[model samples]
Target: MMHLIRLELKKGGFTSYLWGSLLAYAIIACFIMVLYFTGNNLGAEGFQNYEDALNAINTFVLATFIIYASVLLSKLIINEFKDKTIHLLFAYPINRKKLILAKLSIVFFWTFVNVVLANLLIDVLFITINQIFGYVSGTLTITLLVHHAIYVLLQAFGAAGMSLLSLVLGLRKKSAAFTVATSIFIVMIVCSSNGNFNLASIIAVPLSLAVLGILITYLSFRNIDRVDVD
Candidate 1:
């Protein structure tokens, strides 16, 4: 599996995607600053405590990367199927399930790691900026920091698993547009918030989505060896 993933990374030229992720991080940070500050202007949606800020940032980061995961799926899997390149891979003596799993693993781990890292960097940047401007209320204690770490871990794992579900529709349609669009819809279901009604805040929501995603991946792998790449 590791060898297959390394080959995918080398042949796939994932360096460009890494650069794109960096750019996404910078853009997310800028938006966080702008929104939080502007929100403080009217004292409306601005964060009232450290937990509130972390929660908002974590959700935003996960949502953005979940959409980004679809792009990876589009490039790695759907595009190959669409262009008939996947036939060459399936022709090899490799197990089709493992090959596809390698690709999906790339998407899963990429989204997971980036969400955790983005939160760390963005959290520090926002807190520093807030310290200078004194817009947000409350301070970050050891208790809150510990809780944030735990929260980020669960959210990262959940986000990683749920991202696989995006491939379900994309695989059926075999369209990159459909893949990305499905991810956007998933983000809406899990991440979007209205006033105090946040679906993501409910523990069961993300967990159920994650479990469903895993089931989807497992089911797809079952027939992958016999399934032709038509």
Candidate 2:
């Protein structure tokens, strides 16, 4: 399974996706910094402290990661079918279930790692900038750092699970547009809700979505052989 995943990474151009994600992260970090500094000018409620800023940034990124995950699914899974490359994959000596699982594992792992690392980098950069410009209001403490870390990790898992669900939906219909549209819908629903970023909603929403993602993944994989590549 590990070998198969590595092969997929190498052959699938996942490195390019990783680089793109990092670039996106840098852009997001810079945008958040600009927002922090110009909150009053923009007539937005400025972050009350480091915790508030972290939470706001984490929430936005968690939603954005769904879009990233969808793009990865399109490139890694859906494109194989669209391009008629899945026939070659199906011809491999590997079991169909294992092959599909390996692909999903890559998507999940990549999405989760990107979310966690990117958020961590953003937090560090925001803090460093805060130290120099004093734009942010809160002081960083060990306790706060640990709390934010836990929050970011939990959200990352949730984002990964949501990505899987989106992939399954898109792959079932073999439509990249459908897959990405679903991701956009999810982001809209999540961002539009007033409680989505709060602790209770964060824990509850992701857990619910993660459970749904698992069920959908199981159903999708169970019928892998039946997928119509035509």
Q: Against the hidden reference, what TM-scores do the models get?
A: 0.95, 0.91
Against the hidden true structure, what lDDT does model 1 obtain? 0.88
Q: Give candidate 2 misplaced runs (Cα > 4 Å).
A: 40-43, 193-201, 225-230
Model 1, stretches more than 4 Å misplaced?
42-44
Report the C-alpha displacement of residue 157, candidate 2, in angstroms.
0.6
lDDT top scorer: 1
Model 2 lDDT tens row, 1-230: 99999988899877788789888898889889878878845777777788778887887687778888898889878888778888998987778888888888988888899889888888888888888888676568999989888877888888898777778778778889999999988878765546325532457788678779978888867967767557
Please report how far candidate 2 places residue 149 from its true position, in Å: 0.9
Question: RMSDs, each prediction?
Answer: 1.4, 2.3
Write one digit per residue (lDDT tens) for candidate 1, span 6-51. Answer: 9999988999999998998999999888888888886667777778
Q: Model 2 has how many clashing residue pairs?
A: 0
Best by TM-score: 1
Q: Please list the C-alpha lDDT of all candidates, in the order they appear.
A: 0.88, 0.81
